[model samples]
Target: MARTRPRPRPVATGCLMGRLRGNPWAILCVLSLAYFMAQLDISVLTVAVPDITRDLHTSFDRVAWALGSYVLALAVTLITAGRLGDLYGRRRVFRAGVVLFTLSSLVAGLTTTVDQLIAARALQGLGAALLIPQTMALLVEAFPVARRGTALGVRGTVGAAAAVVGPLVSGLLVTVLDWRWVFFVNVPVGTALLLATVLVPDDDRAPGPARLDVVGTLLVSVSLFCFAFAVSQGERYGWRGWFWGLVALSAVAFAVFLRQQRRRQSGDPLVPFELFRDRDYALMNVVSVCVSLAFMGLVLVLSVFFQSVLAFSALKAGLAIVPAALCSMVFGTVAGRLSDRLPAKYLLLAGTGLTVAGMLWTAAGMHEGADWPRFVAPLSVIGVGNAFLFTPLAAVGLRGLRPELAGAASGVLVTTLQIGSMIGTALSGALLGGGAGSGPTAASSRSAMVLFAVVAALAAPACAASSRTPRAGGTGDRAPDEDAGRAAAGRSPCREPRPSGPGRGQGGVPR
Candidate 1:
C-alpha cells in the first residue's frame, strides 16, 4: 500500500509563515532587531545631513525635502499599514516591509542626485510605516497582562534608547564609511531581521470580515500630506496663501475623515473614537507628542552645536551624546522595570519636571564662546529625564488598550512621535535664523532650548490629567492578568462590573 504523502507547507511568493516558533520573549528580541534597524537609520541620517548636502551639491531647501518626504510617507501610510495587518496577517505585512526597507536602503546608498535619494528615503519610510506598528501590536499580543508593562518597557528601552545612541553609531559610520553608508548599513541588518522574524509563531488575524478603510485611508493620507508639507515649508516659505491653503485643506480632510469614521460599525473603525473615551489614553497621547517634541529637537540642536560651534569632528560630536545615551539606557532599563509596579503618572511627572530643569540648564549655558564641558552636566540631566519618561510614558498611553486594536493604537502613537520630531526639527531651524551648519548662535540656541522646555513642561499637566482618567470599559480595580485577558478578547471590563461608577472623570477621561 502506498503511504500517504506528508503535507507541504503552502508557499506564496514574497510571503512567509513562521515556523519553529519561539516563546514570547525570544520573539520580542527578534522584533527588537528590526526596530533597532529603524531607529539607527534615523539617528545616522541626522549626522549625515551636512555630508549629504555637500556631496550632492544640493541647497538646504532640497535636503529638507529629503527628510520631509520620508516623514510624509510615514504619516500617510501608517494608518493604512496598521489596518492591513488587521485585515491580512501582521507577520506577512511586517516581512514585506523589511524587504522594502532593505531594497530602498540599497538604492539610497547608490543614488547620485538629491532627488533620487529623496525617492529612496520615501520608500524607506513606507517600509518603516508597514513594520513599525506591527512590532508594537505583536508585543502587546505576545506578553501576558501581568508582564505586559514590563515587556513594553523592555521594547521601549531598546527602541527609544537606540535613537539616542544612533548619533554615535552614525557618526562613526559616516566618518569612516561616508554618508552613503548610513543607508547601506540597513541592508545587512534588515536581511538578518527578515530571517529571524520567520521563526516566530504565526499571529492570528482579526476574526470575522474586516475591510481596509480605503476611503478613510485616502482622506487621511491626503490630509497628512497637506499638513506636513505646509508645516515643513511654512517658516521657509513665509506661510503664503498656497501654504495656508494646504493647511486649510488638511483641516477639511481631517473633518471629513472623522465623519466617515463615525459611520462605521464597531468592528471596522479606522481610528476607534471609543478609545479616546479613556482619558488616560488620550492625555497620554498628548504627552507622547509633547515629550517627543522636546527630546528630538534637543538632539538636532546639540549635535549642531557640538559639531559646528565647538568645532568637534563627526566622531567627537557623536561621542558627545554618549553621556545622555548612557544615562537613558541605565535609566530606561530601571524605568521599564518600575512601570510594572508604579503608577505611570508619577514617573511621567518626574520625567517632565526633570526635562524642564535640564532644558533650562542646557539653554542657560549656551553662548558663542561656550565652554563645552558645561553641556555635559545638563545633557546628563536630560538623559535621566529620558529614563523616567520614554518607556513609562508609552506603557501608560497603551495601558488599557485591547490587543486587537493594538496595531491601530501603535500606529497613532508612533505617528505622534514622528510629528513631534518634525515640529521640533522645524522649530529648531527657525530659531537658528532659518539655517543650519556652523552658524548656530548662542542666542538662537537659547531660544530654541527654552521653547522646547516649555513644550515638554506641558507634559506635567497632561500626566496629571492622565492619572485621573479611567481604564477602558469604565471598569474599577481588576487583576493585571484579568485586565489583559478581558481586554485581549475585546470584552470591556466595564461590562462585567457595570458602567455606573466614578470611573468617568471630567472630560470623560478613561485610564
Candidate 2:
C-alpha cells in the first residue's frame, strides 16, 4: 500500500485567528512586532546599566557584559539560525525563538546577580538570532514579489522605531518602576508574539532534507565571537596584544570556513554561493556593511554628545533623535513602495548622499553649548536618508535570489549589518576618547561624525554597482538565476520572450 500524505491545516478558516491566519498583512504585523521586540533589546539595557550595577553591587565594566554578550551571541549564531530555518519551518523556528526569548527575559528580570543577567541576555540574543532571519524569509514567502517591498518597508520602519525608542522606554521603566522591569517588559510582548504565530503560514520552509553544516557553524561562530570580542573590548582592555591575537584567530577561522563552504556548496552548505552570483546581491552586502557602520557610529557619537557633553538625560537624548527616527518610519515605507516601481539604486545614492551631508552638518553644528533642539533638522535629514537606504536595500539585495535560498540570504545580509554596527561602536568609542561613560568633548564628537560621513560616502560606488543589471519589472527582465539558466541553454537571456498565451506574461502570470 502507498503511504498517503497528511493534509496541511487550513489557516484561513474557523475562528478570529483562523480568519486572519495566512493573511500576508496579518503575518507582516506579527513578524514586525517580533522584530521590534528583538531590536528593542539591543539598546534598552544600556539605560538600565546604572540601576543594574547599583542593585547587583557590580562594577560598570562587569555590567557592560549584559549588553556585549547579547550582541555577541546574536551576531555569532545568525548564520546557523538562518540555515536552521531553511531546514526546519520558519514559523516553527521563529516560535521557538520567541519562547526562548520570553523565558530568558523572565529569568533576566528575576536575576539577583549580574552574572545571571548576563547569561539571560546571551540567551535572549540567541533567541533573537533564530527569529530575525525567519521574519525576512517568511515575509518573502508570504508576499508576492510585487508587494514584498511594501511589507519589508513596514518591517524596517518598526525595527528602526524600536531601536530609537528603546532608550526612552528603558529610562521610563527604570525611573518609575525598576531596572528589572526592563526585562519584564519583554514577557508580555513575547507572549503575544508566540500566540500570534498561528497567523503565519506554515509552509515557509525549503522543501528538502538537508544536513546542518556543523563544522561550518563552529568555524564561523568562533570567528564571529573572536572578532566581536576584539572589536567590542579592545578599548576597554587597552588594545592589548591578546585582543589583536583574537582578531587574527577570527581571520584564520573565517578563511577556513570559506574553504569548507566551497567544498560543500554542492551539498548543504550554511551559505549558498549562488546567492552572491547576482552582482546586486554581492554589492548590496558591501552596501549593507557601509550603511550600518555609518549609521551606528554616528548614533553612538551623537548619543554621547547629547547626554555627556550637552547634559541631556537619557530620555531627553532619545527625544532629541526622535525626529530622525520618525522621518525614517515615514520615508522608509515610501521608499519601499517606490522600489517596486523604480530602481532602488537611485534611492540608495540619494540616501547615502543625504546621510553624508546630514552627518557633516550635525558635526559642524555640534557645540558644547548647543541644545538638543539645534540638531532637529540635520538629524531629520539623516533619518530620512536612513529610511530610504534601509527600506529598499533589502528589496534590491534579495531581488534575484531563489525562494529556497531566501533564509540563508537574509542571514548573510543581517550578519554583515550586525558586524558593521559592532565595528562602528568600537570606532566611535575610540574617537569619543575611550567610551560613552567618559564625557565626550565637542571636538571629539565632531571628529567622530566626520569619520561616519566618510564611511557613509564609501557606500555610493557599491550602491551604483549593485544595480547595473536591469530589474525584474516585466516580461523583458528575468531573475539572475533564470537568466543564467537561459544563457546556459544557448539563448540570449536579455532578449524579451513572447507572451506564453492570451493575457499571460513571461513569468506565467495573467496580465
Say which candidate scores most in TM-score: 2
lDDT tens digits by residue: candidate 1, 364-480 = 987777766777888888888877887776667766766556677778888888778778877877777654444676677788889889999988888886763326432124566
Worst ten-residue run, lDDT, model 1?
493-502
Q: Give the TM-score of candidate 2.
A: 0.90
Please report the candidate that would top lDDT against the real structure: 2
Q: Which segments of candidate 2 are over 4 A away from where they belong?
A: 1-14, 204-208, 435-439, 468-511
- Scored against the true structure, residue 443 in model 1 reaches a CA lDDT of 75
Worst-scoring 10-residue span by lDDT in model 2 = 495-504
Models 1 onward score TM values of: 0.85, 0.90
lDDT of 1 at 256: 94
